[model samples]
Target chain A: MKTTPEQSEQRDGTATGPGAGLGTRERIVRATARLMQRQGYEGTGIKQISREAEATLGSVYHFFPGGKQELATEAIRHGDREFAEMLRRALESRPDPAEAVLAVAKDVAAELRASDWLDGCPVTATSLGTAAHAPDIRLAASEAFERWRGLVRDKLLACGFGAQDALELAHTVINTLEGAEFTAQVARDEEPLLIAGRHLARLIDSYR
Target chain B: MKTTPEQSEQRDGTATGPGAGLGTRERIVRATARLMQRQGYEGTGIKQISREAEATLGSVYHFFPGGKQELATEAIRHGDREFAEMLRRALESRPDPAEAVLAVAKDVAAELRASDWLDGCPVTATSLGTAAHAPDIRLAASEAFERWRGLVRDKLLACGFGAQDALELAHTVINTLEGAEFTAQVARDEEPLLIAGRHLARLIDSYR
Candidate 1:
C-alpha cells in the first residue's frame, strides 16, 4: 500500500510536482487524463484541471481554446499513447501470442494495484460517462480501442493464426481486459483481472 | 431500427406512457434505471427523473428521502433483477454452459441494438461515473456484479465443472460480456459483443 511520491500526488489529485519539468500544455493534458481516470467526464472541471496542473486558468484557455471538451480530447489521446506503448512492450515480451496476452493482463493488474485500484482504463471511464453526448471524446476512445485491437491482431497473425481468428481474438482480448479492469477497480481487488488474463491465455492456446 | 411504443418512449426520454399501470414508485425506479443506463449517476438529475416518471418532485422525495443517491441504488437493484432474469432465461435455454454463454451475449447485443445503442449495463455506467465517491451506489453495483458472477458460476457447477474452475470462469464470463457491451455501444456496432460471445463459447468448450 506504500506509494511513491508521484503516486501519492496522483492519489491526492493535487499538484503534479513530478511533471513540473514538463511544459504547461503537457502538464495540463496529463493532469486531465489522471483526473478522468478516477472520475468520469462529468465529475471533472476545467478549474480543477488548472489547480491540479498548477497552471493558471488563463494559460489553460490559451493552450486549448475550446475549453474542457478540447482539453479532454487531448487527454484521451494522451492516455491512448500510454496504453498503446504498454501494449507494444507486453506484446514484445513473449514470442507466443498466448503468453503475450497473459503478460499484458499482468501488466495492467500491476498498474491498477500500484494505484490502489483507484485508477482505471482512462478511455473507458470517460467515454462511458459521456456516451453519445460527446462525439469527439467518444471518437477518441473508439480509436484507442481500435488501435489496441490492431496491435493484438497483428501479434496473433504474426504468430500464424488466420485473419478471422486473429481479428476475433483481438476484440476478445481488449474487451475482456477493459471489462476485467473495471470489475477489479470496483471490487478493489486484482483477482478478476488476473483470472481474466489466465483464461485469455488459455483461449489463445486453444486457437493455436 | 424499428422500436415498439415503449422502446420509443424510452428513446425520447419522455413520459413512460406504457408504464401507466405500474405503481408510482415502480415507475420512478424504472425511469431512473433507464436514464442511468445511458448516462451515468453524475449526468442524471432528480428533476429529469421526476419528469420522465410523470411523478411530482414531492412524490420522488416521498418515496426516497435520500434523493438521487437513494433512488439510484433502487434503480441499480431494479437493473440487477432484470439482468438476473435475463441470465436465468438464457442459461435455461441451453443445457451446455458454452451455449448459455453465447445466448447471454446475443441477448445483450439485441437489447443494446433495440435501444439504438443508447443503453449499456446499468450498474457499470453509474458506478464508474461516481467511483469511490458514493458508497451506497458503489456497494449496490458491487453486489449486483457479485450476484451475476454467482449465477454464471452456478450454471457451470451444474454442468459438472469443479468449484475452482466454475468460479474463475464465471468471473471471466461477466467481465468479458461487460467489456464487450461497452465496446460495442461505443462503436455503435454489435460485432464486438458477438465476437466476444463466440470466443467465450469456445473457451467453455475447451474446459470440457
Candidate 2:
C-alpha cells in the first residue's frame, strides 16, 4: 500500500491520528533529515524544520522532548536504516560479489544524479558536522557505517575471498563509493562514481 | 630566521605560521585549510579563523572579501596543491609505485593516529558539507579532488598500467584512504587505517 504523507507521519509519530492533528513529530524528523542532507546539521535550524513540517514549536517539543539533538538522532537513525537496506538489496541483487559491488555503486550514482547532485549519503554531512560537537551523534553515525561495512564484508566473503582479504576489500569498496559520491556530487557529474566502480571491479577480479 | 608569533601573524595573518608567511592572503588561506582539516568548514567559524590568525574580521574580509565562500575557495586551492605535492614526494621517495603507495598510506595512518584520530582529508568533509549548500564551493572541491586523482593516475601510469586502468586504480586508492578515515574517526581506532594501507599494498601487488 502506498503510504500517504499523513500516514507516514502518523506511523512515525509526527501527527496525531485523525482529524485536525498535525503530525509534528514525523514531519520534523523528515524535514530535519532533508535539511541536513542539503545544508548540514549546523546550518539547519529548528525553526526551519518546524516550518517545513508545517508544525508548531509546541508540537515539536511535545514529541522530541530533547529538541534538535533528539530530532537529529531520530532522523539519522531513520536515514541509516533506509540506506542500509538499500545497500543490502543492491549487494544481494547479483550472485557474483564483484557484480554486486559495481551494481551498488551504479545505483548510488543514479540516485545522486536523480536528486540533481543535491543529495548524497545522508550521514556524510551530519557525520562531519557532529563529529566535534556531538560525540553521541557521532557514535550513532559510526554504528551505521559499521553495519554497512559488515554487509559488504559478508557478501565478499561469500564470494570466496579469505576473511582478511574480504574485510579489506569491503572497506575499500565502501570507502571508494563514499569518496566517489562526494567527488561526483561536487563535480555534478557521474564520472567519479563510474571510475570508482570500475576500480572496485578490478580489485575483485584480482582476488578471483 | 625564527619568526615570533606576532611577527608570523603580521606576515602570514595567523598567530603561527605553518612555514614562511606566504603573505597575508596566503596565511588566511593556509590557516583556514589547517582548521578545516581538524574541524571541517561548517564547524569552523569565520570568527574563529579571524581570532586564531590574530587578524581583524575586517582584515579577513579585506583578504577574502567574499567572506566564507571566498575563504573556502582559497583554502581548497591550497589543499589541492599541498596534497599533490605531498603525494608526489611520497611517491618519489621510492622507485616502485606500489611501495610508494604503501608508504604513503602508512604515513597517512601514522599522521591520523598521531592526531588522536582527529584529522582526515579536509576535502572529504568540506565537500560533503558544501556540495549541497554552495555550488561555488562544490566546484572548488571537485577541482581539488580531480587534482588528487590526476596525481594518483600519473603515478599508476608510470607503473605500466593502461590509461583507463591507471585512472581506476587512482580512484580506488584515494577512496580506500578516505573511506577508512571515515570509519576510523567514528570507531576511534587506528585499525582501519592500518588495514587499508596493507590492503592497498596487496592490491597493487596483484596487478604485477
Which has the greatest lDDT?
1
Error of 2 at B69 (Å): 0.6
| Fraction of native contacts under 8 Å reproduced by each candidate | 0.73, 0.62
Clashes of each: 0, 5
Give the TM-score (vs. native) of candidate 1: 0.91
- Which pairs in model 1 have colliding backbones? none
lDDT of 1 by residue, B75-182 (tens): 999999999999988998899999899989999999999988888999998787566578888789889999999999999999999899999999999999999999
Q: Write the per-residue lDDT of candidate 2 for residues B19-74, one digit (tens) a residue.
A: 34445565667778878776777778998887665566887998788999888777
Worst 10 residues of 2 chain A by lDDT: A14-23
Residue-wise lDDT of candidate 2 within A107-194, one digit each (tens)? Answer: 9999999999888877877667476667877888888887888999999888788998888777778777887887778878888788
> lDDT of each model, Cα atoms only?
0.87, 0.76
TM-score of chain B of 1: 0.91
Error of 2 at A198 (Å): 2.6
lDDT of 2 at A60: 80
Instruction: Give the TM-score, chain B only, in order for the candidates.
Output: 0.91, 0.86
DockQ scores of the candidates: 0.65, 0.56
